[model samples]
Target: MNDITPADSAERRRRVARAIQRRMVAHVAAGGTTDFASGPLENDPAAYTDPARAELERREIFLKVPLVAGLSRAVPRPGDSLLFEEFGQSIVIVRGRDGVLRAFLNMCTHRGTKLVRAGADGTCERRGRMTCPFHAWTFELDGSLVGVPGRQGFEGIDMSRRNLIQVPVAEWNGIVFVRAAAGSDELDIPAYLGAFAPELAQLELADAAPIRSSSLAADCNWKCALDTYGEGYHFATLHASTIGVSHYGNVAVFDDFGPHWRINFPDRRVKALVGLPESEWPEADYGGVHFLFPNTVVVVGSGGPGGAFVRMFRIFPGQTPGTMSCRIEVYALRGVRADGDRAGEFAQDDAESDVTREDYRVAVDGYANLVSAPAGFTVVYGRNELALQSLHRHIARAIGVPL
Candidate 1:
């Protein structure tokens, strides 16, 4: 195979989009046919309820690996900063004056106080330096300690030792990744992504811009909430009035790249291609539901009344199995849409509504049964629910657990 290069990336995207479109079109023509596994997979319910398992996942999957912080556009400028908080830990990611991306503990060396606060717009705006709210200790954008209010009080201490504590950070294909645990290994994005790097590069996310966002706390295992995104099997019932009205139910095309995968369920609109020539087939706005291993769901699709948008959900484990927090951010590719575009707004709003109001409500109620159910109880993923089944398999391998 020839090496994938930047020049051919756009062509690759066109090819990927067309291939997915063909798969979706064919499935729709076949009356909602979808890929299926050879047999049903019985997954342990305790995987979601076991405190030990949850903690193990927290360390093995989330903390041990790099976590998606935000888009590179978040801190585009030299002095720009972003505060990333998850699992009770906060990290400050910034670009130095020299244009290098850097991340550090969001702490003041003097007293461990948070160093920066977001402005009214929810972005870290600073001059050339950051000042701690507690002791007024100042640090440069690159995390260098630049000043101390009480210099004479600590004259004997080495100023260099008092700089902000740095953490692991890397930028790739427009995504910003950071490791909250200082003891974790340094980031090697290419090795971390493996074959998925070329696929991500094709998206050209480096130029995508956020249009709108929302965050929510839910009562359920993070995996449970995540499983909801893996299939359209529930669209006909759970989302009958929302997503079901547009997308076909129980129809999807699944492609796996290592632990990462993309699943696409045809929308009713694709039926237009049923009798049309391949040359007349319309391009797919929503390429597919893309899952970046561990925890992030990214889908590039239409916003309904809004237009083209990229919707992302970053799910984080709460302190226990019964709790999880989610952050949803919708972005628009440059020139494809504008800031304050209703398409992006509607997409984010409708998505947040569908996930929180509908799916999460069911998860909350059903999880109760899971907690009280008998020890032999197991959750079954039918042959048709391959995406969800695959997710469980990936999680098992990542955390060294047998599913």
Candidate 2:
């Protein structure tokens, strides 16, 4: 073996030391009780929804933060890939023979061709290899440019020099996340996950099959759509038809872990959570909302020692100023079923039709009015908007965009 340089040895030792220190801190923290507090988000016009300002903010958060790109699983095994678009970049994620997940920009190197024409639903084709219909430039699942039709015309062209551009990607929590930034290594996914990584690991999302998946586009600024989901205060008024069973404004708890925050809506189980007076309250109602930074929201319903169910929200920004898209997924413990489907599964089916329809109608109406408001902008975020503020602040800091 080559001699190890002293600097390299020192660097290795430092990394090991940090890992040990992190574990020790985690052990001590785990031994103690935990508390969650809500953080404040200011109404910053420059960051929230301004077309010019939002563009700069989005670039930093989506392109600079090596967040979701490092922790989501593309494919759990070999020969699998997922194609999607985000942040004005077409992305293709694939699992190589080594079982490593990799991401690439979907643009073809030659003549600026789009390597993968999106399928009907605007997702990956999922076939073995992707073929560009424009000139039939074929790329393997690993993103190597394998063939160029009619190669005789371009003699001495180095095929190896023409491989597809690769994007940064990492896998954690059974989800695949891609970052459009170039020259970025695998992000420290677990650290960005903060206190929730361990809790998330227990879910075994890689094994959890998605019963259904749907995407919705709303005529609202992306932040507006995200804001709508961050708080439960709207449940009583906005979601009255669907979430009426759940009481709001009764008891709430908030917790922050630097960039991450969790806003817990008092579940009916605890006496304090009982909405009515102690005399009229019953036991056994429970739920909470866990908001992750950079646009991933998970709502959890209390089960017992473990979680009962969770609904996932993945928000994507549209190229236009006032357009946004969202993906919703619901998962539950294995073998748990309700009305022939998994307990949380039914809610997911209704997400697009009922839940999303309600949210969409409100979002479109809300943004249209905000943009058209005579006074220009008058926005209100009640105390229940605490988590929304927290999210905004985290996003602001990550993107260097103030709001």
**lDDT leader:** 1
Q: Which ten residues in a row have the lowest lDDT in candidate 2?
A: 27-36
Q: For every model shown, what is its TM-score relative to the native structure?
A: 0.93, 0.76
Give the alpha carbon lDDT tens digit for every residue of 1-403 in model 1. 2255656876887788888888888888888799888899998898888899998898888887778888987777888888888654788888899988888899899979887777766777746888888988999887888888869999888887888888898888789988778756789888888887777777767777776667888889998888888888999999888788878999888888877888988878889899899988765564678888888888877555545567788999999899999888877754345445764567556755665578888877777789888989999998888888888998898889999
Steric clash pairs (candidate 1): 306-343
Query: How many clashes show up per model?
Result: 1, 12
**lDDT (Cα, tens digit) per residue for candidate 2, span 285-386:** 233466667777766553333335566777767776688888766556432455435543564446425756777788778777667565435465555566
| lDDT of all predictions | 0.81, 0.60
| Span of ten consecutive residues with least summed lDDT in model 1 | 334-343
Candidate 1 ranges with C-alpha deviation above 4 Å: 1-7, 303-307, 335-348
